[model samples]
Target: MRPGAIVIASSLLVCGAIIGCERDDMWEQPKTAVLGTNEFFDNDQGARMPVKGTVARGADNLQEDDLLYRGMENGKLAERFPFEITENDLNAGHDKYDAFCSPCHAKSGDGMGMIVQRGYKQPFSFHIDRLRNATPGYFYSVLIRGLRPTQLPGVKFEPDDDKVHPAVAHKLSPVERWQIIAYIRALQLSQNATIEDVPMEQRGELDKPKTEGSNGESH
Candidate 1:
């Protein structure tokens, strides 16, 4: 064959090999599809069962404290906090409450937060008989799982489980959720408190004439 013709034939062979390499057959090579039937395993499930006693990521220490992680004791809602609460914890709770809860539940826990004023559904007042008597675990459950639309049929907020507040689910940690609950209790007490509820030292502050201005100057 002519030299020029031989060169053209060699280039065509190279091009054909390159084109074959780029075909989808490389990616479609033998492999089981997820959930696809596989006779190799006894159960015939392509997806093998996870190894026994395997713990999921970020869940290794979950079993350490049931009350702390799940807000439950003996399979029932916890009646009290899992850890001791200090003044600093309450302060932290106040900050978290104002940042997250105050939008819907209001800083005073009156269910009249700014969002409600702007047309969002008003939440139940924390001072109400039902909520005032609710256990701390109940609040913790709400923070973690949120109110499903069908969870509380006749409840005030009619919380949609799917529409869980992002801040509560993703931002606030478990300890932070407890702190917010403590702050909530404080708000409830403040709203329902009476003269007798005040300490003798603090009672004098309440009796002082209500200040008229931000500067605390008498009008």
Candidate 2:
């Protein structure tokens, strides 16, 4: 009676241990992730709501450079560019302006661009009296907050119902907007600059008399 009862008790104890070792479903169960929803949280949201002063990464830092990003200071259009202009900036500006602005404003800023030639609306010329008097921030504002067809007060705009005209900065960065402005300012100066506007070293060349070249060309 003692040996048989002892063996039966040992077998029952081994079976109980095996039952306790069975896997839990939690390892494979689906659960809500961050920013998701679940019934477990008091508010039924997975992630905790951001605190009152919280901001997106780097946004606060960008806010500090509002002159560069918003193109404004003291609620006015910035009087100057955020950084000093460089030759490299001009080159970048030329490329970006040609790639973006030249389609509607033309390489000459004359408003008769290829797009206009192809039946798009004619934009106001950069050389126009009002535009010529505009500041760098004015052009920056244009890129950031596109010129709506409605914004053109005296100009007749025939809108294309098939097209969606988003603001220029919808795809452009703040830096690119600045670069485009640089190219536009260059274009404006080219049309209105005087002889004194020439660089000191280049000014002397303007006074030199022209000579007849061998092939009826003026040099």
Best of the candidates, TM-score:
1
Q: Kindly report which residue stretches of model 1 are placed more than 4 angstroms away from their true locations once superposed.
A: 1-56, 152-167, 209-219
* Candidate 2 residue pairs in clash (backbone atoms < 3 Å): none
Worst 10 residues of 2 by lDDT: 210-219
Please name the candidate that would achieve the greatest lDDT relative to the true structure: 1
Residues 4-92 of candidate 2: C-alpha lDDT, one tens digit per residue: 99899999999998888756586536677667788786889877766788866755245778789878778777768878888788888
Global fold similarity of model 1 (TM-score):
0.63
Q: lDDT for each of the candidates? A: 0.79, 0.75
Q: What's the lDDT for candidate 1?
A: 0.79
* TM-scores for the candidates: 0.63, 0.58
lDDT, candidate 1, 1-219, per-residue tens? 999999999999999998877756877656788888777889888898768998666661456687987788898888999899899889899999888888888877888888989988767788988788889998887887776545645445533523333325566788998998998988889899888998888877876886656452111
Q: For model 1, where is the 10-residue window of minimal lDDT?
A: 158-167
